[model samples]
Target: MKTAVVLLPGLNRDRDMIAALTKISGTPPVTIWQTETEIADDIDLVVVPGGFSYGDYLRCGAIAARMPVLRALKEKAERGTRVIGVCNGFQILVEAGLLPGALMRNASLKFVCREVKLEVANASTSFTSGYTQGQIIRCPVAHHDGNYVADETTLKSIEDKGQVVFRYAEGTNPNGSMNDIAGIVNEAGNVLGMMPHPENLIEAAHGGDDGRALFAAALEVAA
Candidate 1:
C-alpha cells in the first residue's frame, strides 16, 4: 500500500508517522508539504500527524486547515481515499469540514501526556477492523486541546450510525469529551480523526504494539 504523510508548520509528529508507515507497509510514504495542492492518485492512505500546527494560533489546527494541501486532502477524501488525522490533525479535519464536531481545550486547562485505555466502540470501520468489538487497548495522548464536542443532535446521529470508533475506557476520559469519544470516522467511513498518538506506541520498543493493527488494517497489510 502506498501512503503519504502531510507536513505542516509546527507538526512535529510527521517523522514518527512516516517511520510507522514505512515499518508497517514496508514502503516509505511520500511527504506532502502544506503548499502542495494535489495528492497523487496512487496514494492509498494519507495521514495528518499530530502537533501544534501554526503554534495553535486562533485555535488548534485552525490555520493549517486552510492550507492548499487540505483542499487537496478534501478532494481525495471525497473520492473515497483513506485519511487519518491524529491529535492536532483531528482538529484540522474538523476545522476543514472534512469531519464533524470540534476539539476544544482540555477540560483541565493544562497539557496532558499519558497513556489512556481505549475501547473499540465500532470495530467494523476500516480503521478498526483489525480489532474486535469492545476490545480495550492502550494508546498514548499528548496535547492541550483534545477535548471533543458536538451538538446533541450531531452526537446522537454519529452514535446511531456507529461512527464513534474509539472511546476512553475504564474512566480514562482525560479531556472530558462528550461520550468519552477518542476517535471517530466520517459518514462515508473513509475519513478518521482521533486525538491519540497511535504512531508513538506501535512498536515493542514503545512498550507494546497495540496500535500497530490500526495502521496495518488501514494499509490492508498484515499486523
Candidate 2:
C-alpha cells in the first residue's frame, strides 16, 4: 500500500508531492526517477509532478512523454493504477495519449501565477473524492500554456461521461479553456490531469490545505 512519484529530469516537486501524500495518506511516498523503468511493486499511486521537463523544448512535455519511464507508466495506468499529473505532468499525460486534449499557450499569452478558484465538477474519482460535488477551492496556477482546447465533439463526449473533475469558477477563468474546464479524469477514473499544483496547497503555511485531500483520496497508502 505504498505510493510513488515519478520524477522527470526537470521535475522539481517530487518531495512536495511526497510530503502531501504523507500528510493525508499517512504513508511516505517514494520518488522514482525517470531513469527507472518500473514502479515499485508495492506502489498504489503514481504521481507525475510539474516542472520544466526537457526545458520545455518544442512543446511543454513533448520530450519527457517519450521517456522510457512513461512507457512503463502507460502500462501501469492501463492496469488501473491511480495516476495523477500536475501542470507539465498533465501536458505529458496528454502527449503520452493517456489523456485527451492539448494545453496550448495561455489565452492571455502570458504566464499566469496566482490563486484561482475552481469548482469540483465531479468528486467521485479517486483524485477528487475528498471534495464534495460543486465545492469551490482555491489553488495556485503557474504556467504559460495552460489553455485547454479540443474539438467540440470530444468535449461533449467527456462531459457526457462525467469525466470533468474541476472547472474554473465563473469569472475566474484565467485561460480560455473550453467551457472553463480546469481539470479532467480519463474514463477509467484512475488517471487525472490538471494544470493547477495541488502539491503546493497541502499545507496551510503555503496558504491553503485544499490539496491535501486529493492525495489522501488517490493514495490508498497504508504501508
Q: What lDDT would each prediction earn against the true structure?
A: 0.96, 0.86
Per-model TM-score on C-alpha atoms: 0.99, 0.95
lDDT of 1 by residue, 68-105 (tens): 99999999999999999999999999999999999999
- State in Å the error of residue 34, model 1: 0.6
RMSD per model, one decimal: 0.5, 1.9
What ranges in model 2 sit over 4 Å off? 220-223
Tens digit per residue, CA lDDT, model 2, 1-223: 5788888887776777778777777767887778778876677888888888999899999999999899999999999988999999899999998998889999999989898999999998878878899999988898888898888888998999999999999578887888898899998999999999888987769877887777767764321
Clash counts for all predictions = 0, 0
Strongest candidate by TM-score: 1
